[model samples]
Target chain A: MLNRPATDTQVTHLQRLWLYVLCGLVIFFLIVPTLLVIPMSFSDSRYLDFPPESWSLRWYRAYFNSPEWLQATAVSFQVAFLTMLLATATGTLAAYGLHATRARSSRYMTVLLTLPMIIPVILLAVGIFLTFAPVGLNSTIGGLMLAHTILAIPLVMITVTAGMQNFDINQEMVARSMGASRPWAFLTVTLPQIRNSVMSGALLAFIISLDEVVIALLIAGGDKATLTRRMFLALRDEIDPTIAAISTLLIAFSVLMLTLSQILQSRK
Target chain B: MTAADHQPDAPMNERALDRQARAEQRNLMALSLPAFILVGSLVLLPMGWLFWMSIYGADGFTAENYTRLLHPSYKKTLITTFELAFLVTGLCILLGYPLAYLASQLKPRMASLVLLCVLFPFWTSLLVRTYAWLVLLQRRGLINNWLMEWGLIDTPLKLVHNFTGTTIGMVHIMLPFFVLPLYASMKTVDYDLMKAASNLGASPVRAFWQIYVPLTLSGLGAGVILVFVLSLGFYVTPALLGGGRVMMWAMQIERSMAVYADWGAASALGVVLLVMTLGILWAFARLTGAIGATEGK
Candidate 1:
């Protein structure tokens, strides 16, 4: 019923071509940088150069052998994992509570939750810097996770609440009446339905925590430096193909996670 | 008879049980307490600190910070930021709407694929994406290299480190943001209405302009506001692409705070940006409400 042509076939063809071109442009730009990084990573020269005369795994080996890169990446992963856990737990509970409430109150709470996303990270970093300095959170893992969690929580809340909106609350009630406790009902009846949303939210939270730099720079200082912070420092001091190698790895990791999420989303 | 029959003891027991249930509900709602505590401690508290810092001075509370930002150059920087945000938002809408429309017209599987493509770039690092743009748009980078090879020009074009390069990179980052929301809103539009309009002897364009555009305006507005606000706060893209050529307010704030260690001026700049964002958001909410009312009618 929906696919029937409502207009001239010629126009639709033109539209399709135009759409393809636009989408092609997007795809081209999206992948070009990533592809470019491949050649730069293999560059025979010491600097980041395109269309290298010779290709080798020098930079890749360099990255793998360097303890600094390895340690920074591990730190990034640890921070991201902890931030994801904190964000998911807080966000899922908050979303469920807010979603079950009346519309007006929920709307107000939603805006409040979005503040972390809407406010500038620099402003956030400065405030956290001041607040954490007094409490000795500066240059500590706890401080980094705390800052990252604040930003990540809103993302989880938004995604989970979106999933909850379309849910049948009566089913939850039915489960409750069947002698299932509230927590048990939620686990059996609600969690599975919104599992995809939760996973996506968690993925988003992890990515944000991993990619974040400004807060890490401000609070983590030098000791708790993240991979991004390390890269930022590298860029400040020099331009090298090692960054290209790291970028390639990051892109690959993101793609793998995204593919997994896609598989999960499709199951829904 | 009704008052007496409503037996005092029975009603009292019900009231006590009700109070207990209410207490349980309060506990359940307390699930939100952690979020509240976290946000208050990390977010709201920090913002309060920022506000205090903005007003504080070497001596005490003073107008010096705000007044310092009142300089002509600072004013220019603020205006440039607003202007850049406005332009990027506009460009995103212009380009994003058609793609969203076409995407909505696709089969579900294909639509999902298209959406994946849209989101793929978004998942990539912004730092890397900006750097990629630098390669493609650089003087002797890919674009100009190809152009020169094909005899389009003898000399390489000035592409990177300017307004043109900045716009290109900013728009690339922002397109998906605009597209996703617009696509979400467009999915909710009634295809039957458009078909009915066309079936009633209205041309496709006429029906689209008359009905489709109006219905989708809320989505467009939402997307525009999202992009604009995001662009205002953008740091990496402008920093990389502008290459010290274009100076926006965020860059100025960074310089003041990081380079000069001038917290007062930086905080003042931040407050101004915050207030402007809040004001625009208020306006957007009002517009959405107005549109909602019209839609209800």
Candidate 2:
């Protein structure tokens, strides 16, 4: 194709300038609040103030020292870790199974697996709360982990399935033909090829659990309160710099994990 | 003797291969079984229970919970929730499309860096993001303070704890949902087509509107459906920013369950919300499919 002459580029310059301005404003709007929290977390003031007159580590110290905050953080980590393990394992298996089987029922199963992503989260929380209340699963870490796993499974399935699509099944078949068991063949041949997707999916599941709030609000309580649930209540009940400090830490942690996942994904 | 031996063993090799295929099929079924059970019990079963609770009432089976939706107050809340969702989704498209376009036009490496700004918000917790807006938009918050110092207004704007604050917070959270899909679709567009159009003597604007814009309609459709559905179920942003003044359906469900302890009513409201969301998506998909068919022709 011929590169369009200077006339085309020149004529669109004014329009492009306006597009650039709008894009810049949108980027600023999306990023400014997240960027502001870091500075607000470090502010020496008791109240949230911008362009801090002075900075101190007091709020960070407060977050570290507070039993309630610490417990919530611990619970969040525990639930997220369990969610990562369960979702990744089940989702990876489901993806592989679906890819291997050419049955008509697999399409319907794919829809069933992805329904959690489609349904409103509030609805899920309400349903789970009602269902688990009588069974005594409410206010427990296990219940929260179960809920997070349901939410994370679809993500893992989507990611791992994308990886599975690119894999050459002939390699696994060769392994099987060499007298390897089905599981053994998969472990030796297929798993290594799709390890990146599995890792990324696990990272995503961990983040989903860590950031989950609605379900935690409905089910997780007392000693099992997740970090997000605590931050939510603190925001509602009181306005303090401690929430800011915690928010900053959460942001940093997420950024770190996401970057790590990106690196893993790009290695291939 | 060797040829005779090979011929006799062929039948045995075929049976062995058959058994292995059957074993692999069984293994595949077994591998997927746990996920099926997990999703079934935790997700599908609860959803079924929710529907059952919606219809189940004092006298045995009653529509009282659904009838409650007819009340003027409840109707208003439903209308307002949808209206808010529509407004937010519209704003997201307006702001996101240009940014997505700009990102798509950039060099590959530069595009990823620009796209990171969109993805960063997804990493941060929704509560933290909403709280960040609260801190910035409050009466004595950063925006107001900056405005005052610059002598922009006499009084602090009522930015937070209102419709304005709720909309802004939602739009901020939803912009990425719109942009990422829009950018992905745009990247796949053949810029060469635009060149072809210009070469045919069409003006630049004509080429863009007649060629490029039509190509992006599918992305536009996808982004609209995604943002609209997600926004309809939004609870945290509106609750925190609206300060109980603005009530969406999700908050209503919360109140019904937590405050009133009315399981039937809460479940009924949830069913309505779910049905409406699914119905809208189904309609959107049909509409887009028709549009795509016509465009192909």
Candidate 3:
């Protein structure tokens, strides 16, 4: 509208046809595979072939009924929760550090923090396994949390940093001028401003930890198996429809997260 | 120094604030140390150790590990990894660029919805999405079932347990990475620029390639590097979809650890990968900086 052409404003028929075809292709790519999972999950037969002989909820039932699967799911949730808490707190503090100091060290600190994300996860997994070897930290939930925390910290850092760009430095200055301690000035004046960023980063970290399998698989053993690890093992050992069922559930959960994130971002 | 110019009460308060600010800085650093140490110990130290082991040999320091990696068999593996990463990144760009462009063209409400569709799978496990591909590409899988029904083929095509399946799965998993950054960058593109180009007698295609493409280079650079880096590390997708036949470097490292119990070889492989990643990051940074300097000038 700001810079329109001299030509007449009319919809060309060929352009409209092309537009429809493009939109159709986009919709097809996005929707079809997601929809395909539904019937695949319900296949009455043992194999994963489509055009099911009949549809049933047996796989869904199996997913819920299996103790191993349920336990893994519970573990995943717990790990994700802890990861969010740890990553959000540390990440926000680090972001604040960068904001407050404007220190050259903060740049170095950010690299240190985000190194986990930049490195290959498998390599990170191997590193963690070796690092934990001397201390015998293998296969423990605590060790798994630590590994996930490293990976998750970068996410929190990025999100919180983005959020902190809107920080009102003047507010802190004002508080300081009133003889408030810097910590008090920040806690009372600054933390509240970036709360949404903190929350969103926490949520993202949680989802990342929950959905992570490679690290969880490398570090978490036996009783510490995450839902993803369970799914991987299930897929490798058996062609159960239960995996499809679980995948459907996970996809729904992801969609829910995506919606929530959008709603939150829009509100901002 | 500013306190010297302050009023009586102002000087006292300013002094206190200065002390407090210093304390806050100190405290922040103190709090950050634990995170730094934790990551450094776990990631940094082990990475150093991987490099150290890579150079160490039976007779002391030797490049035998690298020499071993140069074997024809391993060369094939390396080529396949690059090929897979290259193809997957290309496909992601192909599939992602238009959707990003289209999304950019949409109303805010519709754009958000389409963006949501793209990001939906991101929250799910990469393993789950790869597993979905397994079901979709297996010999007796959904696609094969549909094709046989349509008489498109009398026999199921060898889709899964091969390169095609691996590429499809990797691209699906990586598409979001390509789209999100491109979309974000494209959204920031000045719409008026495109319109101005068209109004100045340029065709729409010319406007897009000339204005939009060059402007979007940073995001494209980022998106491609991200997709390539991620694809390099991809394990579950190739393993699950490629069915043991697709021996990726990640699988090689896993075998070196689990089956062979050869820490030296595994760490050496890990070192090679780490170096490759760092090299990519360095190159990306240099390229971006040059672009930035050029843009600034």
Candidate with maximal TM-score: 2
What fraction of the genuine interface contacts, i.e. the true contacts, does candidate 3 reproduce? 0.43
The residue-by-residue lDDT of candidate 2 on B213-284, one tens digit each, is 888988988998999999898888998999878889999998899899988889999999899888988899
Instruction: Say which prediction, candidate 2 or candidate 3, comes out ahead on DockQ.
Output: 2
Model 1 Cα lDDT, one tens digit per residue, B93-122: 777887788788788989888898788877
* Candidate 1 vs. true structure, TM-score: 0.92
Q: What is the TM-score of chain B in candidate 1?
A: 0.94
Best by DockQ: 2
Off by over 4 Å in 1: A1-10, A46-51, A102-104, A236-238, B1-14
TM (chain A) per model = 0.90, 0.94, 0.88
| Local distance difference test values of all predictions, in order | 0.81, 0.87, 0.81
Instruction: Tell me the interface RMSD of every candidate, in Å.
Output: 2.4, 1.7, 2.6
Q: Candidate 3 — what's its lDDT?
A: 0.81
Best by lDDT: 2
lDDT of 2 by residue, A1-268 (tens): 1232333323454545677688888888988888899998989998667778888999999999999999999999999999999999999999899888766678888888888888889998988887788999999988898899989999999999988888998898899888997789899899999999999999999999999989999999889998889888887776777988988988899789879977987875
Where model 3 places Cα greater than 4 Å from the true spot, the runs are: A1-13, A16-20, A48-51, B1-24, B57-59
| DockQ each | 0.48, 0.62, 0.48
Query: lDDT per residue, candidate 3, A1-268, as tens digits?
Result: 4233322222243544555466557656655666578677887777855767788888999999999999998989888888888888877777777766755677788888899888989999988988888897887777888888888888988988898888878889899899998789878998888878888888899889988888877778888888888788777776777888988888788777777777667656
lDDT of residue A113 for candidate 3:
87
